[model samples]
Target: MDKQEQALGLLQAAVESMGGQVRPGQQEMVKHVVEALDEERHLLVQAGTGTGKSMGYLIPALAYAQTSPKPVIVSTATLALQSQIVGRDVPRLLESLKGKLSRPMDVSLLKGRSNYLCQYKLGGGYPDEDEGALFSMDEKPPASGTVYSPLANEVMKLREWAEHTETGDRDELVPGVSDKAWRQVSVSAMECLGSQKCPMADECFSEMARARASEADVVITNHALLAVSAFEGLNVLPDFDVAIIDEAHELQDRVTSSVAGALSARMVLTAAGGAKRHCAVNVDELTKAAHRLEKSLTGIPTGLMDKGLPEEMGIALNDIVEQSRLVLALTKPEANAPADGGRQTARSQLQAIMDDAIRMLETEERREVLYTTRPREFVDGRGYVESDPGTPATLNVAPLSVAGKLREGLFDGRTVVLTSATLAIGAQFDSVAGSLGLMGAGAPSWEGVDVGSPFDYPKQGILYVAKHLPKPGRQLSAETLDEIEELITASGGGALVLFTSKRSAEEAAEILRPRLDAEILCQGEGSMKSLVEQFAADRDSCLFGTMTLWQGVDVPGDSCRLVIIDKIPFPRPDDPISKARTEDIARHGGNGFMQVSATHAAIRLAQGAGRLIRSVNDKGVVAVLDSRMATARYGTFLKGSLPPMWPTVDKKTILGVLKRLKP
Candidate 1:
């Protein structure tokens, strides 16, 4: 048989092995992926949930990789999806194709450097004395003097597991450690000394993973690392001729974040602290310089820096650069030799800070945006109490668009297959394609296909728009709350309410929790996994959360029979990046509002509404509390982006459907 037929056979066998029928959409997606790889063309496929997209792409990718000279890279958007692909889907497919391949099909899962333990750090070899201050072991115990501290306990557990763990991946640790504790044992790519230069080179986890990926037939990675490899020119993964980007809708955002640069007062202070421990540097002067910069930033409003850097801020940044240069000159790595890891890390960080500061101050690139914003702690006082009244803000310099970078670095000489459930907005892939640099003049030609969802959306789900309610303003109204209460009551409380902001979610939860008979869980009460578990365990429970819950959640069946969106998820008026992108589009003779803001809202709205029906047997109602969905001119455009659910505006009809769907 030809490669295409063999791949189809493998897909069919794998699906049947898992007790799933071979879907027509899955078959079409497989065929398109094979054609894309064969012709070395870029392809975008919109395969909705339950199309078994993983296998649809994987089968063709594996078949091609078996005969190709290079390995295939599969990049996903989330660690959860990565785990699902590497831990479940890949293994199941490989088992089904155990003896049918032309060559050995080896697979490896690779993550960023920080996800693995740094042996040098684990051996009590800190970069500097201030490193210990950042991760202190000291504790103020009770009268018993038991020395109880969560950080200390977690460190000990990590140490014990380090000896026995094979991969040393953070995800493998049971009762996972906090981000604060993990920082003590891990090193960022910038912080890591090369494997050849490190004392633990022979046993480096990150290097070992890279070596495995180099030899494997398939390498599973994330979009962030893919961006690092393509844009930063980092050799983080093996060379590949073909790539399948799962959750491709998040690619632009991930790429933008990966390439962005930031400068903050805390980073300067930390670097100064480290330099003082090892080099004969003027720590006090550097500290004062950082403080001056911080004070200057505090004066500027927290938003996009449309104008050039202020005079005072420019002077402060120059002072910081001068100080950083003096420290770097004194703390040369060659002079510090064996114990230079800390000095090198500090030097790299300082150099990066100086470079970004200079770029923001000097560069006149219209394609980049410069902005300053205070951290969440200072904004809301949620996590820690601030010691200084002047909490330092962070200055970010990021690309206004990653389309050009992606086109040049990623799709130049490789075949790419971008697939997602939300790739298309309003029944066309043009908006998303343009965002990904795929639709520009003289760009390589590509094909777009929507294989569609396996679920019977029209019969299994209802889209309820509360057109009678007053238009949603900044907050959820009393009428909207009553509508939510009525729907949750009718559905018997297996509901997931997605809000546009945390304030809205918290406020709604407060009012609904006291009035409703069912148990209500808020986002911040615990980790998302634990919250989802609790929500799934109880049939009469409701979950209320903001953005992350809008897209990342995936609970199927009766546990999520009702999905309610408080309002259309739109870009906030003050969002710096969104504002900049909108204006840029308008300058280029495009409808900035529709091309940038409305498309963003439509994708998120579809994601939020998609939470209702996850399986073919599942039935539910997706209620949008915003009257704009039915009353506004863009309502049809927004509604068209979603699945073909039965639409309605009568509240009574939705309540009746919810009651019928309840177990």
Candidate 2:
């Protein structure tokens, strides 16, 4: 048999050895995915959860990279998946595929600089020399006699360990740290000095990662870095012939987010003042610009600012932009000066931001709009931009289509493979394909295939919709709460009660806390990792969280036996970006609700359901509490977005099924 056939046989063998039953459709999907990759054409594969998708794609990608010298980059949307690939899958697969491939294969994980601790910061060159005050670790003693005394002591130990760290990744640290703690140790891309200029040149974590990436046959990274390299041209990632975007559905959002930069008045002021401490600048103009920018941004509304671009606001921001430009221009870099490095970096960052603002102001698309609002209003002149707590406060403008620009910038130069469990939200790929500007001509033709899941969704999970409940646009009803209590009791304590709003999550947690015996864990209680760890440690823990919990979280096995969505994950009625995108859809004579709101809800619903079955032995009930999921005409559309779970409105059956599973 040929290499493709042989590869498929190996994949089947691997799946069976892992005790995973492959469906006929899933088998076909594996065949087609390999075929598409071999052809060097783009393929959007939707492999629902339970499909051995990681293996299906990995086998082909490794096979292709084995014979060819060019490396393949696997991009995931979450750090969890990235770790799984690098730490677990790659190593295990390498052992399994030994002597099978033509040559030895190497794998590496690449991340943004911030993911790695800066040896300089660990050593004490932080811009703030008052390290003990800035970093609390030095201020306090480690809980007696423990190796980790002050927090700084922990950082020091980590730095010492860095000398022997081959991967130079913080994820490999024995005890993972919080993002806040990580920030104290690591430096962002904009903040990092290149190898030649950096004092820690030979031992830089970022440089080590880069060198490893260059030498490896396969590289793993997240969408943000890939998007940054592709769109912003940062040259952060090593050269690769092809990239497989695992959670392809989230790519556009990731790309848009990377290209879009935001600066708060406080951030600007802090940066300017910080720069003045070292580098020379027109401090007065910088201060004035910060105040003016703050005032101008304050006038813009939060959520979606679809209202046509305001001329007065535009004029006001223009003046501030000009002032910023001048201040940045005057702060010229001096050769080899200590302050020169800081000055040049600050200049580039500010200019890049100003350029983005200029482009936003200049874009002719009528649908494109801008807004300004304070996130928080302090009693004393301190305020921040009011972005959605659940979503980034963003100025989203789909340039009618992104295809032309995407083709010109990211696609034409290389081979791209977009794979996800739910890329095509409505059976038709147009909604997704259109968003990416992939709807046009023979310009890189596209083919789509569905890789069926291993679990018999019809038997493994039940879709419970509270059909008697009212619509969710208004305040959630009392009946919704009642149903939630019943479901929680039915599922016992092993459940993720998903909510569309933090308020709902809080309210539910309050009501359910009094009613259920399980340990109640809420989102605001701690970091996501902390919450996940708590939930895993005790199967009787119920987590109530908002939008973020819907997608990024993954709790396999008995720990997560019931996934409860409190409502249809709808786009907020007042969301500025969604509102504008909806309008744009309507302007094209399409159903805006279906195109925007419903599509968004559909993706989230699928994501929420996906939290249920994360492994071969996993099983659970996905209870979407919104009645619209069953009664409304659009309910079918939303249901289509979910995994093909067995449908059941019968509460008794669902409760029985959930009870039979582990709590």
* TM-score for all models, in order of appearance: 0.94, 0.87
**Model 1: per-residue Cα lDDT at residue 181:** 80
User: Which stretches of candidate 2 lie above 4 Å from their native place?
Assistant: 12-26, 120-126, 129-158, 177-181, 307-312, 334-341, 365-369, 376-404, 441-443, 526-541, 552-561, 613-620, 650-663
RMSD of each: 3.1, 4.6
Q: Candidate 1: misplaced stretches above 4 Å?
A: 128-148, 283-285, 377-391
The TM-score measured for candidate 2 stands at: 0.87
lDDT of 1 by residue, 299-333 (tens): 56677887868887888889888888888787776
Clashes of each: 0, 11
**lDDT, model 1:** 0.84
Worst 10 residues of 1 by lDDT: 378-387
Best by lDDT: 1
Report the Cα lDDT for candidate 2.
Answer: 0.72
